[model samples]
Target: MSTAETLDDVAAAARACRACTDLPLGPRPVLRVSATARLLIASQAPSTRVHVSGTPWTDASGVRLRTWLGMDEAAFYDGRRVAILPMGLCYPGRLPAGGDAPPRPGCAARWQPRLLPLMPAIRLTLLVGTYAQTHYLGRGAMTERVRDWRRHLPRFFPLPHPSWRTTGWEARNPWFGAEVLPALRAAVAAALAD
Candidate 1:
């Protein structure tokens, strides 16, 4: 089968996944991929807005991420260039304290290995936020991991979550803006280049 057709089959299976049948808001897998995609946006999980919209990164955080990559929405969302996949396919629901809960317990370990390899063209993976970084790069502080972006190289670029919570973090770490972002954007451009 063509990669697109194979991915379509995989997506269909993911959409019908009942692994988290007891999820608070139920399961609504939110991911996008294509065989031609060279960039992989590996994030934590879907927020309520993304779940409702059936689109990835449609909120303010998305704006920040797009800005960080110096990409317009069209390019970022283009399936042929980018694949948006999260640690959790569904919105794990809200926490009693406030923010959303962590992505359903073992979702990534269960699904990612099965899904990721299908995209053979992926050359640059933006490991956004703690969950994704922790999963792929192993347990580590977001600051340290993000600071050492060069270590991850052309394959993985670690980044803090682009949520409002990161405003203070970003302010405290000027180097991220002065250093990492430029390299990140350049790598993104290279990966998505025709």
Candidate 2:
């Protein structure tokens, strides 16, 4: 198969995936991947709005994430340049505090290994939220304290979940914006330029 054909096949399978029925709204994994992607953004999962919209990070999280990356909506949604594959594709119901739960384990079990191999040109992967960082980054993950992101800063670009709840956290961790985000922006700009 040609590269385009391969990408098409993968995308079709990604769309057809319904592997996580145990989770809240069933498995409607939101993934956008391409062979030409230079940046891979592996987030936790889509919010209820994102799942309904069939777009990854269509909510406030996406807005904050795009701001952090210094990318406008057009660049952020360009699949060829920005491959977005969340750890869990579906909305995993709501928590007691009324926030949505993490992505289902079944989604990751089904997609990750398959998708990573297809995106050869991915230079920088933005591992958003503790769940993604934990799954991708292993033992060094910041579990209880998402603010202690300093240890894993430069390597994989670890970040807190871009929710309204994290506004104070973002303010408290001045280093995240003042220090880490500049490097992330430069890295993103360089990768996109290349």
Candidate 3:
């Protein structure tokens, strides 16, 4: 099957998912990868706007995310080179602290194994938030805190989420933008070219 066909079929399966409906936020469709993807973008979950719009990365976070990766909108959305699968596909809603809640554990447990095996070409995976990092990076006492990005640098390239809320965090963590972003861009460019 063509890559788009593969992704669309996976998305369809995710749409019908009832696995995580028991959570406070009911299930919505999954956002996923094309079979031919060379890079994997493991983000958090859909923002409420993205869930409503039925498009992944259809918000300001997406804009900053693309910029961070040194990709334009068209390149960022190109499924063949970049697969945008969040830790959770649907919006999990907001916490009382005014932050978006973490992705439901159930979604990753149910989906990633099925989806990842399908993408043979994924060379570089960007773990773009705490949830994605924690899931992919595994539980280690040394790398548990998001602030300990130094511990997991280069290999998985853990990054803070590209949300407006991160502006303050970025200001505080100047080394992230100064050091990590250039390396991230180079990695993305090389992967896309390959």
* lDDT top scorer: 1
Please say which candidate is ahead in lDDT: 1 or 3: 1
lDDT of 3 at 182: 84
Q: Give lDDT tens digits, candidate 1, residues 103-122.
A: 88788987787788889999
Segments in model 2 whose C-alpha atoms lie over 4 Å from true places = 1-5, 141-155
Pairs of residues at least 3 apart in sequence or in different chains that clash in candidate 2 = none
Q: Candidate 3 residues 84-175, lDDT tens each?
A: 88888778888898989888777887778778877888877888877887798775432234446546544456777889988888888787
The regions of model 1 sitting more than 4 angstroms off are 1-5
- Once fitted onto the true fold, the runs of candidate 3 whose alpha carbons sit more than 4 angstroms away are 1-9, 22-25, 140-155
Shift of residue 74 alpha carbon in model 1, Å: 0.6
Indicate the residue-level lDDT of 53 in model 1.
92
Q: What is candidate 3's CA lDDT for residue 116?
A: 83
lDDT of 2 by residue, 14-100 (tens): 788766657667767688898999888888878889879998888988899888888899999998798988888777889898887
Greater TM-score among 1 and 3 belongs to 1
Error of 3 at 142 (Å): 10
Model 3 per-residue lDDT at 101: 87
State model 2's lDDT. 0.77
